[model samples]
Target: MWVYFLLVIAILAWGAHLAWRWKQARDFAPQLLALRQQEGELPPSVSQKEFTDLYLRAEGPRAGTYVYACAAFMTVTLAPVSSLFNSVWTAIWQATGSDPVFEVGTFIHTFSFFLAVMGLTILILAIAMRRYYALMPPNLRQVIRHLKDAHS
Candidate 1:
């Protein structure tokens, strides 16, 4: 029951995320094409100003909200495993002691949640990196820069 609930929520979150990504792509089609024409591959992150300008047109906040919700879906699967799974999760945890598998509908819930979490994390990191450039701490920035330079 609880596992099913988590699965449903995660599925919904993924759906929302997909829709938001589609919208972002549609909104940025012109810029996307321009980049492809000039640079070959798309840039990693659009500038914050570019995103902000696009966001201001409408649906920006909604897109951001969807990404955050996706993360919530991921969290729903982990941590305490959800109170809804008290009986099963507790029993399994007790039996296995930290090797608990999600009860019943867990596979779907776990996949959806984990995927959503990754997607949300990517969106946030992209946005932050786009605007702040080096906000992910100096060490991380240096590593990324080194890798990027190496790639180039």
Candidate 2:
């Protein structure tokens, strides 16, 4: 009963977290678009909907620190699962009259560090405007180009 209660609480917490992130992204969209306009980063002929859509997609309200923290937490949480699986596999092999499959080392900390670094790198690359814009559909891309031409 207690376990089920805890599970429900955890699910609710996760949902709330997602809602917060979504709201943050939505609310910051206007400001982000405005900043892009001020910096002459936005296309002059773009509509509000188009500008907001691109800005929201490129950058959310959360700071870089929040991204890093989430990455670190994910790495730490999953690290033990890898070790547990390896240990279980080694036990099964030994029971089958075979030698240990591989030597197990305490690499969780190092592994987590490496994972966090890689995760942050990927996140940064994904949020870059150039990469994001490049991946947009042709129609949207054409619209952006028109906006740029109008501004120039």
lDDT of 1 by residue, 27-131 (tens): 665564355435634345544354334433333344455455545544554445444445554566567655435443467545755565576567755665465
lDDT by residue for model 2 (84-124), tens: 65667567656777643333443653465456557755665
Q: lDDT of model 2 at residue 151?
A: 67
The ten-residue window of minimal lDDT in model 2 covers: 100-109
TM-score of each: 0.25, 0.39
Q: Where does candidate 1 have its weakest 10-residue lDDT segment?
A: 135-144
How does residue 66 of candidate 2 score in lDDT?
45
Instruction: Estimate every model's Cα lDDT from 0 to 1.
Output: 0.52, 0.57
- Kindly report which residue stretches of model 2 are placed more than 4 angstroms away from their true locations once superposed: 60-152
